[model samples]
Target: MCQLLGLNCATPTDASFSFTGFCQRGGATDHHADGWGIAFFEGRGLRLFVDHQCAAESRMAEFLRSYPLKSRNIIAHVRKATIGDVRLENAHPFSRELWGRHWVFAHNGDLKDYQPRLHSQFQPVGTTDSERAFCWLMQELAKSHAGLPSVEELTLTLRELLPQVRRFGSINFLLSNGDALWAHCSTKLHYLVRQHPFTQATLMDQDWTVNFAELNQPGDRAAVIVTTPLTRNEQWTAFEPDELKVFVDGLPVEVA
Candidate 1:
């Protein structure tokens, strides 16, 4: 299995603090060390970085930890290489263009004997089941809507489409289109929101703490979603099995 991390904020915010602790799981702390990648959405443009090297030792991951790149939406993945070879193309947080917007996706679980008929525009460049599933979702979305649908509409389509994929195996994943982030739980996942009157939090994988209240303003809000709780002290809510939720402006919004 792989590890997933996502951030959605009311305003542009840097992920350096969370990422620093997350990168350690790629090799130093846990054993998901095949490869890792991340994507940050800035307006319509995306900053994507992928490497075949382990995140804990990769220079690119270290650079990201030092650089405070601000983004409204971000997705990251650390691969453990269950289905594909350790290569750059297998690195996750994969991106593709759809309806004039960039869509990013990352998966944390493995699927067995899962292969969908992708007879459309969207196609996978990697051999991993995660990428294949992403392409199939994109293909289906494109077929269901003439243009980019609203977040609510997209959520509905995803909810309808995901069951077919989940039948194969665990399909925990994160998806974003710069507007909102959608997270689905087939096995394990957790999330938490940080808002006004923030407090100090310590990382579970690393001996690092950050006082978010010292840096953030009253209006700032952020929602972090991960495969597991990143901070030891913060209260994280676990997602129910087969649950799919959407986050906008740092809060979960109901859609059907």
Candidate 2:
């Protein structure tokens, strides 16, 4: 299994704080240490970084923790190999282009004997089931609509489509396209939102504290979703099994 982390923000924001604690799970504080990757969406452009090395020990991960790359929608993962070899290509947080927009996906669960026919333009370059599943989702989305649909419309389509794959095994995942972020839970997931009147927070894995009120503006807001709670003081809400949620501008939106 792997660990997932996502941030959907009202304004462009850096993830160094949450990432510090989350990356520790790659080898230091937890067991998902095979490989790790992250994706940052800036406007219509995307930045992706991946490594086959354990995030806790990788120099690349350490450098990233110091770089303050800001993005509105971001997805990251620390993987523990279950289906593919420990290689760079098999890392999570896979990326693809759809309707002229870059889409990023990361998964924390494994699928058993689940292979969907991908006869469309989308195809997996990696042998991991996570990439295969992402390609299939993009393929089906292409067939369902002529172009990118509204976020709500896409949510409706996903709700109908996930069951087809979930029957095979756990499918907890995070997906984003620089605008809105979506999360689906099969067994484990948690989320929390930070907004106005922010408070001090402490990391669970590291011995550091940050007073967000001193760092964030009144208008700043963010919605963070992960496989586990990243902070010790934040009120994180656990997702029920088989639940799906979408966040836009740092807040969960209702989909009717």
Candidate 3:
């Protein structure tokens, strides 16, 4: 299985703090170290980086940890190599274009013998069940709407489409289109929102503590989603099995 991390913020924010702890899981603090990648959405433009190297040891990951590139939406993944080769193409979070917007997705669970009919321009470039699932979902979404639908409408379509894939196996995943981030829990996932009156928090994987209240403005807010809780002090809410939720402006919204 892989691990996923996503950030949706009220304003452009750098992921260095969260990613520093996350990349540790790729090889140092945990065992999912086949490869790792990340995506950042800057308005209509996107920056994507994928590498067939452990995030803990990769120079690219370290550079990102030191550089402060801000984005309103971001997605990252550390692979464990269950269904794919340990190559660059197999790294996530995968990116594709739909309705003139860049869509990013990353999966955390393995699907057993699951394959769907992919049509149009949606096709898998890597021999991974996760990429196949992403392509199929994109294919179906393209068919469901003539153009990009509203977040609420897209969520509805996803709710109908995901169950079809869930029947095969666990489908825990994170998806974003620079508008909102959608997260589904097939097994384990936790998320927390950091907003007004922030407090100091320490990383679980490293002896790093930061007082976010000092770094962020009063109007700043961010939602952090991960396969496991990353902070030792922050309150994290676990997602219920089969639950799908959307986050916008660093907060979860009710979407039917």
Superposed on all Cα atoms, the candidates' RMSDs to the truth, in angstroms, are 0.6, 0.6, 0.6
lDDT of 1: 0.95
Model 1, range 146-250, lDDT digits (tens) per residue?
999999999999999999999889999999999999999999999999998899999998899999999899999999999999999999999999999999999
Residue-level lDDT tens digits of model 2 in 1-256: 9999999999999999999999999999998899999999999999999999999999999999999999999999999999889999999899999999999999989899878999999988889999989999999988998999999999999999999889889999999999899999999999999998999899999998999999899999999999999999999999999999999999999998
Candidate 3 per-residue lDDT, tens place, 160-236, comes to: 99999998899889999999999999999999999989999999999999999999999999999999999999999
Q: Which ten residues in a row have the lowest lDDT in candidate 1?
A: 118-127
Clashing pairs in 1: none
Q: Can you list the residue pairs that collide in candidate 2?
A: none
- How far out, in Å, is residue 107 in model 2? 0.2
RMSD of 1: 0.6
Candidate 2 global lDDT: 0.94
What C-alpha lDDT values do all the predictions have? 0.95, 0.94, 0.94
Q: Where does candidate 3 stray beyond 4 Å? A: none
Spell out the clash pairs found in candidate 3: none
CA lDDT, candidate 3, residue 56:
97
